[model samples]
Target: MVHPNTTPAQLSSILRKCAAASVLGSGKQAHRHALVSGLIPHSTLETDLLLMYARCGRLLIARQVFDRMPHRPLHSWNILLSSYAQSSLFHHSLALLHPLLASGLRPDHFTLPSLLKASAGLDHGRTGAALHALAVEMALNVHLIVSGCIVDMYLKCGWLVDARKMFEEMPEKDGVVWNAMVTGFTKAGLLAEAFNLFQKSQFEAGDADWMALPSVLSACSQSGDLRKGKEVHGRAIRCLVLESDAVLSNSLIDMYSKCGFLDASLHLFSRMRVRNLVTWSILISGYGMHGRGKEALRLYEEMRREGLEPNSVLFTSVLSSCSHSGLIDEGRAAFVSINRVYGLEPSVEHYACMVDLLGRHGRFVEALEFIGRMEMEPAGSIWGALLGACAVHQNVEVGEIAARKLFELEPGNPSNCVALCSIYERAGNWDGVAEMRRKMRDLVAVKTPGCSWIEVNGERLCFYQGDVSSPSSKLMLQALRGLLG
Candidate 1:
């Protein structure tokens, strides 16, 4: 309850505290107190109430407060817009700009960044370009924050050329801008370009910021460039940033694991002074990926003994480890424990892993029964897992069932058609294979070709199926044949 003599300033302070703590109940109480104290018409108090609700994720209540405001300042509009964007309600955020314009309020630098972020989330390149134009019109493009957001938006929307142009044209480049470009290239699977930019940032800035190193490490992990990964580790150590940042340390562990250096990953893990759930999760996943399920489970138990509760992601990793190692009984117990032992519902991923485990061992009847008992509807991943297992075991009848469900659920996925065709081929059903090909043609579903990356002499090379255009392809093939011989 608010004191009877509470002034507007005191009430505003209370609202800020509630917002900072994200205490929606306290925020609502403050709102009631403001109303009771006849402070409803005060602009500052009303705006504070709106911000409190917005920060607490009570967006509908915040909107109501905003609408009821006698005067909605530009700051209030920005808060609402940012709240919606941050919540990933992209369409709702975009819709608010129209009313703001209709109210004769021009968007300032703060407004455009949120809209740009919303555009990026929706992958709406046209909307993002329009916002960029508006920023230029208002001469706000010169602002570092606005320009960085534009670059990030363009990159996320897959407009790499535009993003690069904007990035190159920036008069001043800070760590935020550099990180955006480097991370974008890394995510786009252009590891060479990402590393090049990372090097360029070091040359220009005299040192690499701790932020960009994680993306570069991720690129190294994806390409299995152990040399590059170690180079980055050394650089992080020289910069004295690795020990201070858990996220960077996690990235290093992940890179080493993916690069087929489990011992190095474990050594780093043991040396860390503090370890979080993510750190444990990465190590467990690494063990699973390398087919060391027993070790993975041991580490998982160790994590539990440390008093940290397992989340859904950790459970998925554990189940996946069990599936890969053919520990069907262990997988089943883990699946049951997800709900009964931990009070966490088994997600679609957990169901898929269980199906894969049973189906992989040719237990079709048991797999089907398990599917029937699922609390939620089976998704495309579940069917896809069953179909993959069927192909492996040459189970034509169950393969067809899985493929049919996959076709209905994910019609555009050509992998399903391919899996069913493989099953038919294994069973000597030429007619079935031809008919499946006809369906694939009708659906225009073309399977993506396989690709691989290799690092040679500090350069990353990508190879696609039937791609022999590289000058060294013949030499590499001959070397591979010689090694096999």
Candidate 2:
């Protein structure tokens, strides 16, 4: 309750502290008490009230108060911008910044982080750099959070050299800064660099730093580097970071599964005391990747039984498993169940999976009909799947149609051209095959070679398009050929 003569300043302070602590109920009570006692006028109290609502994930309430305010401070606009960014409404957050600036509110360091984060998601590196220049002009760009945001923005936008330069130029690097670099490299598929950085990060640690482990584990998941992942897990255990953390356990499952250790993935999943949706999805995806569709479906049912609805990703994994294992009925049943039971509207990815499943089963006509009936345009993958099935079944006419669709969808991708050529080859159309090759040449499309790697005696050995570059290449090739035989 507010005192009869309480001032607006005192009430604003209380509201701000309540918001920072995320005590929404207390904040709401205080707001009501302030109104009843007229201790805090609506104009002065609106900013803090909006902040409180935003902190509690009530954006609509925050907007209502912000819209009703007679005059709002620049910080109030910052709070609203931050609220949108935090909620992952990035485009909406960016749309508000221009109007706020045009109205004469100079964005400070606090405002730039959210804006940079939104730009990162959109891959707008040039625009982000322009904003960085604005931050410098305001003398607010040197702040740690803003620098971190710039690093993250460059990394997400695939400007790795710029990201590294930003990292190197920083006067002081914190755990958050290092973690962002690791995560950025991992997402860009720079596995060797991520691991090298993880090794270097050990000497750069502090007693209180705990954010880097999750980023390191994320690198492990992407790179399939089991040894490094285990070493990091050991350190996490020592730090008590994974004693009961479901998120870390899910990461462990993903890393282990990628490394082809399904047993270890299952073990980690079993040990998790509190499993969230991601945990279930990781396990489902792991099982699908390993071709254990029955087990994947079993876990899917168990997740629903435990009151967890399968998201689109979970359905993707289940559908992929069914497609790979020739479980056509099971795939169809799961697809139907997605809409009927979980209430998740099927996406283009789900449609692609369905086409793959049907096409692989030699239901070419049905697959074509499904593509035609899609609520949205068919993506390259859907057409490519039908084309591949036609190639396997030696159906020239259907393959030709699918090829035309694939070519139109992904003209720049040489894989589609190769698919069309393969279809021509299967149909004994020598001239058509030559024409497809000529088209590839005219388009300057080069097929990217497939590469694989394996570790031998603690050294990674990589092979590219049958290239022999390793010191032990001959022995490795012999062993592989023996296994093949």
Which candidate number has the best TM-score? Answer: 1
Identify the leading candidate in terms of lDDT.
Answer: 1
Model 1 spans > 4 angstroms off: 1-65, 68-72, 87-89, 205-208, 462-482
For model 1, what is the error of residue 28's alpha carbon versus the real structure, in angstroms, after optimal superposition?
Answer: 7.6
- TM values, all candidates: 0.88, 0.80
lDDT score for residue 389 of model 1: 94
> In terms of TM-score, how similar is model 2 to the real structure?
0.80
Candidate 1 is scored at a TM of: 0.88
Worst 10 residues of 1 by lDDT: 202-211
Residues 160-232, model 2: lDDT tens digits: 9988998888777788888888878888878778767766776775633446676777777776778888998
Segments of candidate 2 deviating more than 4 angstroms: 1-7, 10-77, 87-108, 134-142, 207-210, 301-309, 341-343, 369-377, 392-394, 456-460, 466-485
